[model samples]
Structures are given as structure tokens and as C-alpha cells.
Target: MDKNDYLKAVDRLNLWAKAYYTDDSPIASDDEYDKLYNAVVQFEKENPDLKLSYSPTNRIGGEVLDEFKKISHIAKMWSMEDIFSDSELVAWILRGDKTDCEFFAEPKFDGASLNLLYENGNLISAATRGDGSVGEDVTNNAKVISSVPLQIDYKDKIEIRGEVVISKDDFELINSERSKNSEPPLANPRNAAAGSLRQLDNSIVKQRKLKFYPWGVGENSLKFNKHSQIMDFVRSLGFLRDDFCKVIKGIDELKIAYKELLSARELKPILMDGMVIRVNDLSKANQLGYTVKFPKFMVAYKFPATEKTAKLIDILLQVGRTGVVTPVGLLDGVLIDGAFVKNVTLHNFDEIDRLNLMKNDFVTVIRSGDVIPKITGVFKDRRDGTQSEIIRPKICPECGNELLDEGVFIKCQNLTCKARVVSSIIYFASKKCMNIDGLGDAIVELLYQKNIIKDIADIYRLDELSFIGLEGFKTKKISNLLLAIDNSKTPNLDKFITSLGIEHIGEVAAKKIAKNYGDKWLELTIEELLSLDGFGEAMALSYLEFMRVNLEKIKELLEFITPKIQNLELKTNIFSGKTVVITGTLSRSRDEFKAQLESYGATISNSVSKKTDFVLYGNEAGSKLEKANKLGVRTIDESEYESLK
Candidate 1:
């Protein structure tokens, strides 16, 4: 309504964008941010000539990295409209009445996407997903990636979409280097590969050893009449395509494959967050054509988020252990898997930018195990744009200290934020922390809310009688709880360090720190911490700051309770130790049979190879059983599995 309002609105959007893009944490709910963004749009709309050119609405994204040459795509790569449930996906399919149509289901890799241009069998160019329509060229760096072929045998021109991913092993190696350099370790492999590809220096990208796997096509000169044929041809030419890609001949088969892939993906080595279904007939694909954005012949079906969706009632900003204020999405209470989920983490400002979400909007949230639930993709079709955009606070919501952007995380400059203290205390008592069984989430919330427990040390002073007035504290339950708390006094060094709830430090980091410091945690100065094998500077600083507050308390607590530390002993083994395979109709359940075999240190393999020691079969055993018999893999029936057990 006024100049101050406009300035504050713009600042909020900018702050959110920076946090989301760089820190992977957001300070506003997507709906809240969207509401504010819509207000900005309305302001510009009401006053024709007063539009801000640098407004978030006009920018394709936050900051376009200047390191790579930008190129506009032949066709804009619009993101898919995700349907989280099978019934929803089936409804979408039923809307299309075309006959003889088949959908090809393939695994969706969790990695960085790349668009490649190949002219006459040689890679002409490559680009990263900078703004969807236009992107920065990284052709030279892409060439060094092992999975990306320099030259293909295909005679015609073709463009392909692939994802750059670092293997689990490579992620470990890269973290080791970061630890040695005293830099903060990368979060996940996907993030690691994305960071490596964006490096200004090609030498750094080369050192990362990223792998590329082909997924979609862009421009192609191939003469194939079917999508499956084109894919097969691409594979023959030595391009790494998804081998699990299934071609269904009819509607029933298509549905079955879709369901099968959905289940199998959970146990797969490479992460598959979703599935892509494409028309098998190439002529039909061309006939269907494209909308302004998405192709009509292809649709990507994403798996349901681990979290539940509910109406976004409101948004709240909570400061983390690092002092970054994160805007969490509050829901109109929904029950998912018997658990009530009322909030979801927004992850940062850029996500807010992409979703344009607003408060009071119905949104989706995902949560798994002990990891905090996060807001996944938003459903934009539900929006009418009346909601306000969320504004990130200029100062820390907890301590009133200005937040600092480390390009990795936002931290509170204040040494004593109550929110951070509570979060740290809660995290320290978590399962991975001291493993204090009775100190559940409900108890932690109670302790924090009651002001009785400000830190981990407070747990040591509390007695069974102290919890007598607690709502759920029955005589027997309180006795068991007290005994568990008493047993936790002798804490393992790793668990003790982990319980401190330091930023970016997990079980692994705690072990590395404990191994170097032993019992003299204070004696292990910042310099000594930075010198350790996996100690990076950012992590070292975070650890030191956390210890500065809790170190003395920890020493005092140890005097009352001696923590039992578990030394993890490592081991090595060769594949020659065990070898096994499966065949026939497994009536006993394949998974159970495999588990039984594996318990004996035997390897269960698919497709009977020369090295297979034995092939367990059952009644109605199909091609695999016959093949195993031919290959002399010592075929046996379901009874043999029972006997082995």
C-alpha cells in the first residue's frame, strides 16, 4: 500500500531466493511467498509505469552463473505436472481414449539434468538447466564425464537429455577432499554432481568424475518409427540408456510395469524418484504433437511424496542450530500412516520462487523416518492468487541477529538463540544421539515448552519424581524411562558428540571428531579439529561454536554419568566367499528366500552367469530355470531352499 511496504516485499523475496538457491533452506512457506509475490504483481498491475525490472517475477531464476555461455533451447523444457497417486495417474490416462497406445515406464534418476546436441555422431554442445528455456553451455566439461560418449556411431543428428550423477563411492571420495581442505562437506551425491558441473574451471569438473545417463531426447535425425526403436538404436550406438526401460505392447502390460517399477524402485541401487511413460509408436507421438510446453505423447508420473498433503493454514519461521530462520508450512491437520503431520519444511527461498505458493493454499508435504518432512512440488491448478507472499526476516527470528549467507547455509550471528538451543537439545536426544529410548519427540516438545530443559545437561539433573506430574508418566512407564536415562550416562563418544546437534555434523563426523579428541573434547582446539582427516573449516567452526556452549556442561555431566563408547571395527571380504542365484516359481517368496541365503553369507544374483554357484528353483520355473540348467548352475527346487534354511 505504501513505499515501505513495496521495499519490504521486494527485500523478502530477494532474501528467500538467496537462501533457497544457495543454502538449501527457506525462510517462508511457498504459499506465503506466493502471496507476497502476487501482491508485488498486483502493485505493478495497479500502477502501469511503476514496474520493477529486477522483480523476481521477471527473472528466469535467482542468479544466472556467468561462467558458462547461455543458449536458448529449441523447445522450452517445461516441468511435468506431477500426480502423486496411482489412481490420479490412471484417471489422467483414462482421459485419453486413443486405442493401441502403450506407455513405456522408465526409472527417473535423482541427479543433475543436461541437454546434449550431437551432429553427425559427435557431441556439438551441452547445457545445464539454468532457466529451463535457456541454459549455460558446459560442453567441454561434459566431455570429460565418463558416461557421456564423445562420439556415437549414429549417422544422423540427435539431441539427448541426460542426468549427471556421482556414484555413492565417488561422493565419499569428494567429501574426503572437502574434509582435508576444511570446507563443509556436500550433502548428497546429486548435489555434489550439480556443484561439480557448475565449476568455472574444467579441471575441477574433471576431478569430480561425474557420470552421465541418457533419459530423454531433444533434436534427433534418426528414422525410427517407434520410441522404443529409437531407444534401442541409441543403446546400440553405445550411449548409456536405462536398461530397465520396459516396452509394453498393451494397456494391461503398461499398468503392470508401472506398478512393478513403483515397487522395485524402492530397493534399487540408483535412486529413482519417479517414472516416465512415453508413447511407444513414434508416428503416434508425432501425430499427438506438443502443447505450448509439454509434449502430449509423454508424461512423467512421480511417486507419492513421503509426506502428506493438507491445507496450508499458516507459515512459521524457526531458527536452526546454525541460526538460519526456516519458514515451515503449517497444515490443517492431516493423518498420514497413523502420524499427524501439521508442518513441513520449505527447504529455502528458491523453491518458493519456483512454486509461487501462498498461505491458505492446499499443498503437499513429504516426511520419512526421523528426517524432517519437506514440501515437495506444489499443485498450481488449485491457486486463485489471493494469498500473500511470505517475507524472510531481515534479522534472525530467534536472536535478532542478521543472518549470514555462506552459499551453503544461513547462520545466526547470535550466540544464544533460544530456538537454536531447543533444536540442538532435541536433536542431541534423538535416536542417533544418546539413544535415550524414553526421550521421544513428545517428551522433548514437553520439556522445551515447559522451560524445564534448555540443554542436554538438564536431562541428567531430572529425577523420576520430577516427571510424576507429567500427563503420561505412569508408575511403570516412568520407572522404565528413568532406568533408560540412567543407562545413557555412559555415552559413546560419537553419540555424545552427535547429541550436541552441531550444524552439518552427523554420526560419521562425530566419530571422526571423537577419534581425534578422545575424552578431552576441550583440548581438541579448533586448529586440532581442522587438522583431522574429515574436518573441514566450516564444520570445524560449527563444532567449535557448539562445544563452546556445551563443553563444560558435558564435562560436569560425565562426572555424574560415564558414557559407554562403542568402537566400530571394520572388515573386508571378497565375492569368492559366497555365490548364489534364483530360478523357477518361488512359492516361499523370493525376498525371504534371498534373505535366508544372504544370512549364510551367500550372494543372490539374477541371470545365472558362469560364476553362479547354485540356482534355487521352484514349481513352474520359467526361462530362468531352463537357462540355469543349461549353464550348469546346479539348479534346485523350493525344497532345497527349505533344506538350506
Candidate 2:
């Protein structure tokens, strides 16, 4: 710990940084690195005359720049041609007679691509991909990204190109923080990252946790046979590169690689819209290159658009199982992520106000996979003379019952409302509930209309004659349904409770309550329910009211079915009486971790609150982690979780 340690400290810290950022491996623990970093800082302060441009401290942040200077890329940064379908990919390969071409496929990151300029191994400047040829110099902002190397071992000039992206979890956390500040939520991670890199103050970018990933180079001195080899060389020079990449020969291997890579969509580190397929051999790729705008050697296989512009045809009220009336938007037919979205949920009147939506107004509809489509924003500029303000409903659309206005929500309190009853039955037979596999919403509604099933008790009293005249009911289908219904007669105690469709009592709460009360569920008191970790006064009251109202119906249903309760002899642990909230990307699935923790007597809740005693978090943990820290709640990482067990 002397002046001689200066050189050693700097070298050791940078090497550790490289290991963590580039190699996805850590040579030293975070604390160990911090200790050495602190020592280096102290040494620098003592020896005030000394200076080192490449010091890791320099990467912390720099002076606020007035504006970004333009940087002309040494080599043209070519955008790839995009192919959306298998047919398009095949056409591209066939036209170029590229059946023999070895393909280099990598995940297509949904972020702003950047070109980093380096000479004599020192990263001197970085630029945003403004156009294919020119870009905005964002050197200081780029340096803030830990994954962007400060210096490499290369002797010749190179432009280490990659996309600057925020992880999905971090993006959500950022939006959560923005929500608290009354700022507009970011549309997507790509925009957030692109905006972060353009900030005048690099300190802001540093807080955003931007990561740089090398995909391709603009100008490089190294000689490599394949694109994969160049990627490896760039990674060796300390750029963050991932292994979800492949080198394949011929069209068959290319298709197989694409399928395999696409199947791993959810496992990617950052948000990716698709996969990029490149001609593998570098010299051959160069010869096959350059269309008017894009390189012929590379093409991006884009995933379907998850967000698209659509016109709001009208607004309609849709009542759910709980009788909550939600404003559903009737959208002009639009395709979003492969789903033809004709209707979208505005959620409630509050959301209607938030987006300032109107009939015939153009809006952005978003849908991810099979998740319900929603209108996130309205295009005020797109409004014309024909657009009209939507009239808010004061009554239920289905039953014409007077609605109860409850601040953010409007509800049809009438239990006899057909929509409510149908929804309730559908919810009861959901996979997490009674799990009647053959019973879906459409069938439930048909049964209700036929008057063959009206209540929970009615489901068990049915026979072959019950479904005889129903449309789409073949004998075999009817038999399968009967079997499914019979098999669901003995639902787990928690599942049965969830099937009751009680307000504010989801699977999480039901499971906790069922396990605590077991077979004595009917004996539970309001005060006892209130004692549960997640149950508040309102929830407790709802539980009591439902039990009191449904007591006779429950008794009748009990004759036809059995609710099997868990007999637990829980192993005691530190989490025995603790309320735990899980967040972020974990080594295992969150559900697996939740079940594991529950087995150790932990009460798992969906969100972070003052009541939470522990927050189990992993990589890129969101605002919950920040809230947990602020609340002074104990946080446990994966290693700590293992140790506790």
C-alpha cells in the first residue's frame, strides 16, 4: 500500500473491469474491486502532480458538453436489409446464389447502434448512428457505459461497433422512477437508450446503466476469415459480446440456426426485435456487399411489429368478473405482433383521461405476444374535424344497471348481471382455479344462455343430457368435458378459494390464506384475515362479506366437490415470518424461487412495500430494489439466498 502500488492498482482494476464487462466473468468480488479503486483514488489525491488519462476514474463522468460534435465515420456504417418472413429470407439467399454462403447469425438488438473509434488501443471517440455515413460524437456519454472499453490492446485503428441498450428490467425501473416524478413513461427501451446516449451531461447517462455490445466493425486493421472470428477478436479487445451467436453453412443450417435462435428470444440480455444474419467469410462478404442503402451480405430477420398506429373507432364498456366496468376501445383493424387487434382496453376512465383519447382519433396500439392489447398514447396531431370526444358511461353496457363510480373505477354492483356471472364462471374454471380444461369463456357463456349452468353448484349436477343440444358439442367433446369437470371436483384448497372470484383476492392471497387456515377456512374471522401479510382492512372486509353471502352456496357446492388442503410441517428458516418481494432476472425462474422461499415459510407478495421484510433481487433489478433500499429492507442476492438455505 505505497507509491509503487499505483501502477499495479490501475492495471489490476482495469483488468478486473475487462473481466466483468467484456468476458462476463469476474476475477474479483465487487467489494475487492471497490477497495482497490478507493486506494487508487487516495493515491492520486496524495500525489496531486500525477496524471493518467486512461484511469478508470476518468470513466465515472466528464464535464457537461454544450453540444455533440459531428463525427464522420472512417468507414461507412451500413444498415442491413430487413426480412420479416421465411419467404423473404429464402428469396434474398436465392437471388444472390448464396446457398453455399456460411451465415453468421446474432441477436438483433433493439437499441441505438454506435461506432466506437479507437487508435493505438485507446478509445478516442464514439458516435451515434445518425445516418449510414455520418454520426453524432458521443464520446463522453459512451465512456459512462462500463461495457465500453476505455482502452484495448490493439495497435491499429478500429471502429468497434455495437448497439447501446438498457436491459428490459432497467427500462421498467427507469419508467417506474419516471412515473413517480410525474414524467411521461418511455415508449420503449430502444428510445430510452438512444435518448440516454444523446444527453449533454454524461452523468445522466451513467445513471441509466447503458451497456455496449459489439455486433460489427466499421474500420478494423485485423485480418479475419469469418465474421464470427472478427467478433471474437473484438470481444478479446474488451467489448461486451454474447454467445447467442452461430456460424452455419448453407441455407438449411441457416434456417435451423434462425429457428433455434428465435426460440431463445426471452433469454436475451437486452431487448431484441429479431436476429441478424450475415455472410460469414469476411472477404467474400465484402465482395457481395452494398446495395444502394444496405449491405447485400447482411439482413435482419425482424420479429413482427408489437406496436402499430390504429384509429379509435369507438369506446365500449366491458364488464369483468368483479363487475368493474372498463372502457374498451374498438380499434380500426390493425396488426400488432402478429395479432390482429380489433379491440384494446383503455383499462378505466382514469386511463381515458390520461391519454386524452377520443373517438376516430389515431392512437398507438401495443400488444406483446398474446397479452391483451392496450392504447398507450393518442396522436393529437392526427386528429381531424371528424374526431369526437367519447361519452363516459354511467351504466353497465351489458345489463343497463346503474354503475357505482369508485374514483378510478366504475362497477356494475348487480350480481345478476349476465356479463358478471359469465365472467365469474369463466374465471372459476381458469387454469389457476378449478382447472376445468374443457371449460372456456365461450362455452361457459353458451351454457349460461342455455340455462343449463347458472351457478358454481350447477357445474357438478350436469350429465350427458346437459350438453346434448349445445352447438359444437359432439359426443366425444361432451364426454371429454364431463371427464374434465369430474377430475376438477377435488381442487386444491387455494384453487377453490381463487375459484370463488372474490374481489382483491388473487391466487397469491388465496394460497396464503388457504395454507394458514387449511380445512378451517370457514372458521376464519375478519381480525384473523386482517392478520395475514398481504391482506388490508378492505380486503379482509371483502373476504368476510363474500363468506357471509356465499355461505349456503358454498355448503351446497361442498356436497359435490372436495377442497384438499396442504398439511405443512414447514422447515424453519430466517425467512419464516418474513414478507418477501422478488424482482429482476434471476438464475432460476421467479416462480421457482417463490415456491422455494414459500417452502421455507416466506410470505411472497407481488410488490415492494413497507410491510416487506426482504427483497430477493438479481441482475438488473428494477425500482423495487431501489424502494427496498430506501425502506431499509434487507436484500438478498442469489448467493445469499443459497447461503441462507
Candidate 3:
């Protein structure tokens, strides 16, 4: 490649690296990515003078973070030196004195490590482990973490350590959206959570529903210095801690706990990469402490590699939300980390070039515990010279249209890919959008498949004639669905904006845009939109450009629909600004009630508590009701809710 191509490749590599590290979701596959990466590496090696400063291979995750306040640690938080195999771990243990030792064993959670400070029973600060000694303080954002209490029960000044992790359910949900939006899928929950926490916009962080759990302490926090006592004390302070922790008396008991922990790892919520062993006794811990960075009293016991070799059969293209084409690796069947692996996300075109991977190539694959097996490395020696170069589709697989090269991604130019259509339909009928009932993904797909709907606007044109011969469709069901669709014709300004699926504009962002633009949603200039809170230059320009191109089509559709303005007069109503929680089976589905409440401009809390305005109950309410009663929140039965509605 020429110098210009080399420069371009380096720039792209850096962008992908940032997306991989900061975004947690990578746009390219390991093979494709590594190929580009290796090319840069090789180029830098061959012509050292031509190497650029922004090259990805030279960077670490130590950039100065602005989102959080910088702080100096009382003690250096060194990364645990890893031993990948059992023999290596045993050797390390034997390399040091082992007599009179009691290891306090716990799981090494795969999440973002955080350091928390508490003084006079209240949380003073929380920071990420940026380097060893200094970190970005994220105390304000940490306050939103329900697992990390703002005030602990303990009175003494204390510093605790923990990891922030996004739950599997949330991770899947986020990744699904990311895939739809043509963004790279997050590799795992750990990266997903870390990325979410580091987002400059707190609202995005809020939407992520990030959680934290205490794992270690920075300085003296309790009367006891032993690992077991410290854990118990930390738990008592209303912080979530690893549940599998055990005080093992000796190596035999330690081995037992390790086995038990490994077994229990299957049932744990957070991902466990390995087990951490610390001295149980305070005196023993202090005596064994300080070997450069890691405490001699503690060592991480990593699990054996569950990796195996697999053959690259072929590459498949998949379309995402924003029409980005993704490459998926079809591999020879292999068992990895207890799961069968047939396919793995290849990421993007850049990845294919980087790995120098092609069809029929042998690759080393590893399932990093219970997740998908990824091609970590390629075995060039195994190739028999019959390997075929996999071609990335120039058109979208889902919707056959010439793809648009959007710098980082090869996106579908088709405006109506099935995935995009489904997402758009869902968004249009969503609670914060048009608030249509009985309209979800299944119904949307069916409507599209049966040729009853072509777009969101087409939903209004559906009748019983078009609905005939569909699965499980009854007269009443059809009538109700039609009524819901018809009712959704009247959309609110905020809802209309949200339904547009404008880039970076969700419900909250939509509301801000609508309010700022007033009656001139389309008339508002890009500069005007960019001035709105949380609106960036890129997002504003993207929205404006999309609107400018699609405005006429939208305007024509508007003739068949009317803007549904809620009684903004109800702003002064009793429940207007108050947050409410509803538990138990409602007269309608929980989603329905949430929709109804939100329509009237009320905030919905996921959990019941004292601050909750009211807990709307139905038949057979569970612990939430009991908790609400204890907290003295107003309890309203279905009858009361019906009367209010």
C-alpha cells in the first residue's frame, strides 16, 4: 500500500480501536481488524520513520478522562498479574512462602473497576481506575447506582473498591438496538457497562441502567483488616458484594471453594473471569502484603482456556438498524466454553483485511466462558493453499440495495429494510411515540408479511379485508388492533419527532427537539437544533439533512393524520410531576399502565419506595406492595386507578 493508503488505514484502525475500547462494540471482526492492524504494525516496523503518532497499536486506555473529576489514590490500584493455567498458578504459589496462610476466595467479576470513598457515613466520591494512582471521579453518576448507597450505615471514613457491570438482559437489549442502528455489538456485559458509564451524557448513562458492586477496599475502612470481615462489613453498609466469597482455612478448603465457585458461576448474574484468593486473617494479610503492586496475601486463580480450533467456512452479511452491513463468520462446528459454536460476529470489512482470513482458513477460537466463541487468531501454516477470499456483499442481504460506504460502515441505501421497517413501526407505536396498543414486533412483521402494511403510514389504511387469513386473527382482535392503529393517527409533537427515528433522538431527545422547535419542527435550522441541550453538531446536521430529504413525503402523510396534543393543561394535575410505581397484575398489562401514565406526563419508577407517589396495585401483589406499605407510599387499588383514568 502507498503512504496515503497507509495513513488512511492507520486512521481507520485508530477509529475502530476507539469504538472497540470506548464503545465496547467493535465495527470489525477480529480477523479483518487484525489484518488492518497488522499491516499498520508491519508498516511501522519496516519504515519506522513513517509511523504516525495516532496509530492504535501505540495507545493504552490511559487518556485523561473529563467526565469525572481526577483524583490521586491513597494506594496504587495495580492490576492483578495473571496466570492463565493451573500449573502457572501453582508455581506462583510455591514460589512464595505458603505456611500459615489462609486465602479468602472470591470471584473476579468481569466489569469496570471503581474506587469509592465514604466519609461520615456518606459517599463522598467514586472514581474509575484510569491508571494506578489517578482516576476520574464519577460521584454524581455513581449516586444513580442503586446498589451503591449514597449513605452507608458505618460512621468511619472509608474507601471501598468494586466493579460496575451491566446485567445480561440489559446488555442484550442494548446490543440488539446497536445492531439495528448499524453500530457494533458490545463484546460482553463488562465492556457494555464500562462504555455506558464513560458516556459524556448522563442521560445515556441513565438509559443504560448501570449497576455497581463493592469488591475491595482501598484504605482502612473497618475495625477488622481481614478479607472476610471486611466483606461482611461492606455488605452491611448496603453495597452489593460477590455472593460466592468464602473463608477457606487452608489450600484444601481453598480448593473446595474454588470448585464450588466454578460450579456456582453458572448461576451468577455477573461474569466471572477467575477467582481471587486473599488471606482471611488480618494479621496474616498485613504480613504478606506488598510485592511491588499486588498483595502477596492475594492472587487471582484464572480458569483454564476453553479455547479450541475451528475452520472458517464462509462469511455472511447481516444488515443492522441503520442499514450497516456486518460480516458474520460461519465456522465449522466446535464446542467452546460449554456452548456449540457455528457462527461468530465478523464485525466489519476492515476486520476481514486485518486477519488475512478467508474461507476454509483454520483459526483458533475461544468462548470466554458461556458466551460466543470468537476467532482470536488465524493459523496460516494450516492453510493448504485452497483458501478462498470471502467477498463482502456490495448490496444489503436483507434488502438488496447498493450499500453506502459511511466511512466506518458499509450501510444499506435501502430505506425500507425489514429490520429498519420493524424498528420504525415499533418506534411509531411506542408509548413515548404514538402510544399505539396491540402493535409490537410480531404484529408489525405479520402486517408487513401479509402485505397489509408498507410503512408506519400504511397501518392507518389496514382493514379486515387485508387482515384475513392471518394466524390467530379473530374479529375482535382485528377490530381492537385496527382501532389502536387508527387512534395512533393522531400523534403528539414529541411523539412524532420520536417516531421519525432521527439519529441520536430518542424520547427525551425528541421532547427537547419538539419543545425547542415549537410549531416549526421542520422549519428549524441545523444551527437552531444544535443549540438544544445534548444536541451535537453531527446529530443536528444528520437530523436536518434527513428532514430536508424526507420532508415532502412526511408532509403528504400528515394529511391522513393529525397531531395528538395531550391536555398540556393537565400540567397542573395531581400526578403530573410525581413519579409512580405500579406492581402486581394490573387491569391492563404493566406496559399499558405505563403508557397511560406517561401520556399524562408522569415519571415511572421501576421499583417501589417511599419517594414513589403511589403504588397502583392489582390482584395478588408481591414484595413490592409490602415494601411500598413499609415505606408508607400511598397504595391505590385498581378501582381507584379506574376512577382516576
Candidate 4:
């Protein structure tokens, strides 16, 4: 056979392999594909120079590696903004002017993103999407994937981005085998795929049977007019493509496609959490550009959350770090979104009343974007006369104090509630607060159980000798814990305030309050607090009540810790007391610029409004720049910003 005949045979077999492995729809029998593949391999061996880049012989597995390296991507991989509902999706489409535009829609695979680099048509490197800019090299594991082409049809250097996923059947089979061997079963298909790809042994990855589906081009020498054209080109290069990817003309077609995909989601062999819609025209997408986090040209439409029904066995009252008494519904074990859930948050007493929840009642539990389960609704039809009505608690379950009703929420008025103390200590040592290492929830619970520690102050007083014989606590571990506790004694004011676990006072709010009041924040009156921006009656009242009740405790905590306050008053520059809005992409990261501006006492506002005193514009300024111009805010470029500083 001639070179042309060999090329045709290779393409035919490649398509057949893709159809059977990726699309799960075989066009030819295994024997036929194998016959053509062998013919192409023989031709390639006889005429090595005439061998095509995507010859069927290149599908053989690759060598193992001692360790995975790290590689930088040619282009940054930006995540898409998520839209939850149809209305939000419509709003996003209209924002990009759907009348003159086209869209390419495909399933958003629930798996790890992998970037493949090909040079001279040979696979050179493969990396995991580790933060977009840099990634871990997984070339050996990537080569083991049958769907991942070892050599592509393209000649020049090109980068392709795709997802690595495990089919449900393969996942279950692997788990069953592991169970037979008395090994721990993998969690889910996504986890299994990631774990398999990261294995040091390439043979283990090959055994897992992971698949790849190319969705986008990262960096390419060839230019395409539209995204659909790029997809076609990628498919021609022998890479597995998403079979359902389609081009739509307008919003109506987009809506129809979304509905179709949603309906077919259950039939898909791999997990798909949502559908990704991108602007079809590449030039238009470039013009639309991106924000600090996501591109404006595309949006992900998430499917409705998975839910399961479980019988409410009992209701447990739990105290949070803020002393709020929350109702937790204990349920019979049920699977939802691949995880077994036996409890769901009722949120408050109002939610229990809203659902009219009763013991033994069947409730619908939902696991949306959060790990915690929530009871969305009750199945009234399934409830029998044996079910008992839910009763509101009259006292705190931990401290035996009478609960105080506060409209939608009920609080344990006692600040010394044991559960509240435990939760507060845990929060204080959390990464967002004092960041005490080796202090986890279980350890905090154990300390509380043994009366070794009582409060945040007690954490600082712990001696290494106290943990001498504690389970899992060796001398080195105890020394590390004591060192962490000692290091946590000097927290910044914002972190200290956040560690207090005040209601409605998170890290951001705490930072704002601390910046405005400085060292005198604890001494601020309710009226003074109400005068501050973002402070309302409820928040002001909460602050006043907490300060008044816990003044002595606060003083005692102050004795044990040093709260470092940022002196905003020291900034007497021109930017001081000004509200600034930043637009477009600057040379440095947006976060760095924001921090610099804040250091000079300038407040950063997300949007351009009449109150904005200055607008710092950079390259590719978009709607915010137009808004700033219309509002007549003083605009400056990067050079002007440097001059001002």
C-alpha cells in the first residue's frame, strides 16, 4: 500500500477507536479496526519517513517515570463564570449581545483539567492545571491514556486543554477489585481519575483506563476563525473530542441545547455537572476579554443540584461559634451526588416550621455547591400518623441555659456554653484567624473533654508537659503545638476581631471596622459604630451588646495577646480618603494593586459610581471605563498611577 492508503487506514482506525472509547458508540467491529491498525503499522515500518504524524502505531503505551516534573503553560487557563438558573444564563447571553453572535456549547466535565503540548506532531509534555500559570508534569501517565494521542497530525508546536475522566463502570470495577483485595475503595470517579493520574507508577495509571476529551486550544500556531472550526481541527489531529459539542445561532438555540444536554446528562458515561457555552467567534471572544477571575465571553450553566429523600430520625440542637442554637436533622443514610449523607442542616427553627418537619418524616436533602447537606423540602405525602411534630428547644443543650429568641434565630445567651467555647476555640485556631498549626477540631474536642483547655486564652497557657501522654502526641508533636500556640499570641487586629466569632462580623467586615476605628474599635459607642459606612442598626446593636457583655473577657484576652493595628491615619497623601475604582488588566495582579492603594488610604470600589473619586484604567478597559467616563470620574493610566504614588 502507498503512503496515502496508509494515512486513510490510520484515520479510519482512529475514528473507530474514538467512537468506541470516547463516544461509547462503535461504528466498526473490534476485528475490523484491529486489521486496519495492523496494516497501517506495517506500512509505517516499511516507509518510516512517509509515516503520518497520527499513525495508528503511535497509540502504544509509553515509558514509566521516576517522578513527575513541573511545567509552565504557554497561555493561562481562565475558569468560566457560573450561572445557576435559566434567567441568569439569559442575562449573560444578553450581556454579550446575542443578536449578532453565535455560541459553541459542550458538557462541563467533572474531572481534572490536563494540558497537552505537542511539538513536531509528537507528544512532548502533559501537565495538570495547577493554578493556570504552572502545572505538574504528567507526561508518562498521559501517554498511558488510549484516547490521548501520542502523536498528532499537527506539525508545529501546539497546546490542547482537556479533562481527564474515569467512566462510571470502570470506577465501580476498580473499587470492587480493591474491596476484594481488602483495600480502601476510591471515593468517586473524579477522585479516582485524579488519584490514578498522579500515581508514581505509570502501569497503575494504565490499569485504571482513564480517558481524555479535548475541549479547547491553549496556544496554537494555526489560527481559526471560530471556536467550532478549532474543535474540528482538534478532532482531525486524532484527539478525542466531545461528541455533543455543537454550534448554535442565538439564545433560543442555546436554551434548546442546554435543555437537551440536561436531559441526556443521565445517559452520559462520565459525570457532567454543567454545560459550558462560549462565544463561537474567536475574535469576538478576544474583544470580550476577561475579569480577574473569569472570561466574560463564556459562562457555565450549572445543572440543578442532586437530591435524595431520607427519613428524619431525630432533631439535634447544636451551638455554633457565635452561640446560635441551630437545628440539625438526623436522617437515615441516603446517597446524594455520590456521597452518603445522614444529616442535614435545618438552618433555624423557622426552616423547621416552614417545612413542617416531623420525626420519621421523609425530607428531600440537597447537596448543592457545598459539602454540607441541607433539607430543602418535606415529603408530606409520605408522612404517616406515626410521625411526631418537631419541637423547639427551650434551653441550650450544652450549657443548660434558657435560650433567647431573636426573631429568626435562637441564641444561647450564656457566653460560657461548653459547645460554644469549644467552637470558639476551634474558630480562633482556624487558618483564617490565628492560624495555629496542629490544632484541629478533634484535638479541641479532646481538650474540652479532658478540661485541659477552657478558652482561647487557655490555648496560650498550654504547656508541653500537659500533652506528654496524650494519644498521638509525641514530644515533637507537643512541642510543635506549643510553638504554634505561642506564635498565635500576636495576631493582627482584623484576625483578632474575626476570631471572636461575632455574628455578621467576618474577616472582611472585621478588617473594615478595624481599619476605620484602629485601636479604639472596642471603645466605640453604638452611635459611633452606626455612623460608619456599611454599619446598620442591627450590626451596631450586636456589636454594642457583645462588647458590653464581654468587656472583662475581652480585657483578659487582650492581656494574653497583642493585636497589631494598621494605622490608616499615617497616610496623608493625595489618594487618602478617596474612593478609587480600577479597570482593565494591569502589569501586576489586581490584588497587589489593591493592597498598594489601601496602604495609601484609598478605598477600593468594585464598580464605577458617582462617588468614585478616581478611575485607574489599564489595557483593554471595558464597560467600567465607559461608566467612569460617563460619570466624569478622574481617570488615570498606569504611568499616572506611579507618578501619583
In candidate 4, which residue pairs clash? none
lDDT of 2 by residue, 1-645 (tens): 676688778889999998887677889999999999998898888885773656798788756876678989999887666676788888989866788888888888888999999888788899988876789999999888999878788879988889998987788788779889999776667778889999988998998989998898888777788889989888877777767888878777777777877777667657777889989888878788775557888888866646789999988778998999888899887744323468887778888888888899998887753347888788999777898877777888889889899889889988878888889889888776788988998788888988999887888888999977676677777888899999998888887898999998766677778888898888789889988876799888888888887799889999988989876446778988688999976745776787677767778887888899889986446589989999898998877888887
The weakest ten consecutive residues by lDDT in model 4 span 58-67
- Of the two candidates 3 and 4, the one with more favorable TM-score, higher being better, is 4
Task: Give stretches of model 1 more than 4 Å off.
Answer: 1-66, 75-78, 307-645
Model 4, span 479-564: residue lDDT tens = 87889888988888988998888876655557678888888889988888887766689888888888888888889998889999
Question: What value does the lDDT take at residue 279 in candidate 2?
Answer: 91
Reference-based lDDT, residue 271, model 2: 78
lDDT of 1 at 114: 91
Those runs of model 3 whose alpha carbons end farther than 4 Å from true positions after fitting are 1-66, 180-182, 308-364, 367-645
TM-scores for all predictions: 0.41, 0.51, 0.43, 0.63
Which of candidates 1 and 2 is the stronger one according to lDDT? Answer: 2
State which candidate has the highest TM-score: 4
Task: Give candidate 3's whole-model lDDT.
Answer: 0.71
lDDT values of the candidates? 0.68, 0.82, 0.71, 0.82
lDDT string for model 3 (406-463, tens) is: 7558887677788677677777777666778878778888888877788777877778
Give the least accurate 10-residue stretch of model 2, judged by summed lDDT: 332-341
Off by over 4 Å in 4: 1-72, 83-103, 117-156, 169-211, 232-239, 248-253, 291-293, 305-310, 333-341, 365-373, 394-422, 435-489, 503-561, 569-645
